[model samples]
Target: MFRTENALILREVRFKESDRILTALTADAGKMTLAAHGALSKHSRIAAATQQLTYAELTLFEKNGRYTVREGVTKEGFPGLRQDLGKLALGSYFAECLEQYAGEDQPEPELMQLGLNSLYALSEGLGSCEKIKAAFELRLMTLEGYAPAEESCPVCGRGDIREPVFLPEEGQTVCRACRKAGRSLPLTENALAAMRHILHAPAKKLLAFRLTEEEQSLLSAVAESWLLHCSDRNFPTLAYYRNLKL
Candidate 1:
């Protein structure tokens, strides 16, 4: 049978001679691996379509419940990202995360939109990479039911949040008094405010918000802790970001 859909290139790996195994995040299918034979050769449509970070329309054939790309048409190629190494690595990391977290046969239309929007923003918005990463992580976790709450305290039943604490293990904030007795990642008032903004800010506001360097550092650390705690794997790309100091 024929299956036609839009897809985002999540990853691709060489398969045998002149073939590549492409992993794509699609509108109807979350993630899929397809073999494109001789795809790297000149004048191959599959080669053109399978580039990472490409948003393409694919015509596929499914036999025995496996999807194979018969042909593809490029709709949007995130070329600007390719020009900047940081953007490219960041995009690749996000693509890998999308592929790793979501698997084939579980469709998420909104997540697809978020991925596209982020790539577009990388091209069009101010190069505030930290904001973009945080925004995506915030919304991605939220969509996955992990976004932290903005309440006065997310721990110990109740407390007015004069100075909230971010507990990486808990994935939320706790009151200062409540935090003293519990395991937590310590955070300052300014960092707490930044976290609040990350939790509350709408999509369009991420690139616009002005965050201090110190706040960015704190937010980055907190986010890393949260992701590491949740994903259960060290994000080497994120570690690369940490080394870049931006």
Candidate 2:
């Protein structure tokens, strides 16, 4: 059987000497692993489309419950991301996040769209890497049904919140009174507004927010801790991105 779909190449690993294994996020089928023969060769047509972060239309042949890539035509490779190490690492981190949340044969179009939009923002330099990463993490958590409550402090129910503190493990924002309970980070009003925008902004307007350097750092801290707490695991690409001075 043959099937065709639009997919983004999240990862590519060499199979034998010439063939490659592709980890793709398909618009119609979510995540899938497809084998591409002769993909390592310089003359291979599918080479460009098989590279990580390549959004392409793929044709695959299936037999015995396995899918093999027959052809791939590239759509968007976000070439600008490749021009900078930081952007490339961030893009890789996005791919890894998608790989973790997406499941085989399950359609998650919103997640796919979010990933594509984030790559576009990185490619176009829409925002600073820290802002982009924080926004992506917060919004992604919301999409995965782990959004942090922002209405009031979950502990004190104080609606007029001042100097909010976020508890990552609890996925809640608390008032200043609750900060001493354990390891918690300050979530400034600006940072809280940023998270709120990420959780509620329209799809096309997701990357439109602006923030000061201080607010950006606060948001990054809260976002990183929240994502880490929710996932309960660290991603290698994220670790590398964090280590970079950029």
Candidate 3:
């Protein structure tokens, strides 16, 4: 049977000489692998749409629980994301995060929207890369149902978080009165505000906030820590993104 879906190519691997295999996150089907015949060869229709970071509409032939691309139409290749090493690395990081969190055949529309919106922000140069990454990380977690408690300290119920402390593994914010020694990362008020904005803002306004360098650093730390603790795996793409000279 033939099944068509709108998807983002999260990963692509060369297969044999001219064929390629793609790991794609579909808007309706979650994540799945699609084989592109002759994608490496000249004059192949599916070639452009099969590249990593390309978002496309794919028509696939499925049998025995596997999918092969019959045709593909490119929607957004996010060209601007490739213009700079930093943006490219960050885009890869976002793709890797989606690959980890999205499941096969388990439709996650919100997550798909989050990924597409983030790529759009990056591709359009709408904000600082650090701000975009921080927003994406926090919002991705929130969409996955692991959002940090930002209204008050989970342990002490303290509403005043002038100096907020975030516990990554627990997915909670802690007040000074409830902080366990060595158990939290210090979050500046701006960092706290950034996270709140990411989780609560309108879809069009999620990346509307700005951050100072110091706040960006703190938010990056907390976001990365929470992602690592929740994912419990090393993301090489993220590591590479971090090591690049920004």
Tens digits of per-residue lDDT, candidate 3, 116-217, equal 999989999998888888889888988888887899877766777758988876888887667886668888877788889888998789987778888888
Q: Candidate 1: RMSD over Cα atoms?
A: 2.6
What local lDDT score does residue 49 receive in model 3, on the 0 to 100 scale? 88
lDDT of each: 0.75, 0.87, 0.88
Q: What is the lDDT of residue 191 in candidate 1?
A: 69
Question: Global CA lDDT of candidate 1, please?
Answer: 0.75
Give TM per candidate.
0.87, 0.96, 0.95
Off by over 4 Å in 1: 155-160, 181-194, 200-208, 240-246
Q: What's the CA error at residue 39 for candidate 3, in Å? A: 0.2
lDDT of 1 by residue, 84-178 (tens): 78887788778866776775688877678778888887756554777677767766776677887656685566645655667777676877776
TM-score of 2: 0.96
Best by TM-score: 2
Per-residue error for 70 in candidate 3, Å, reads 1.4
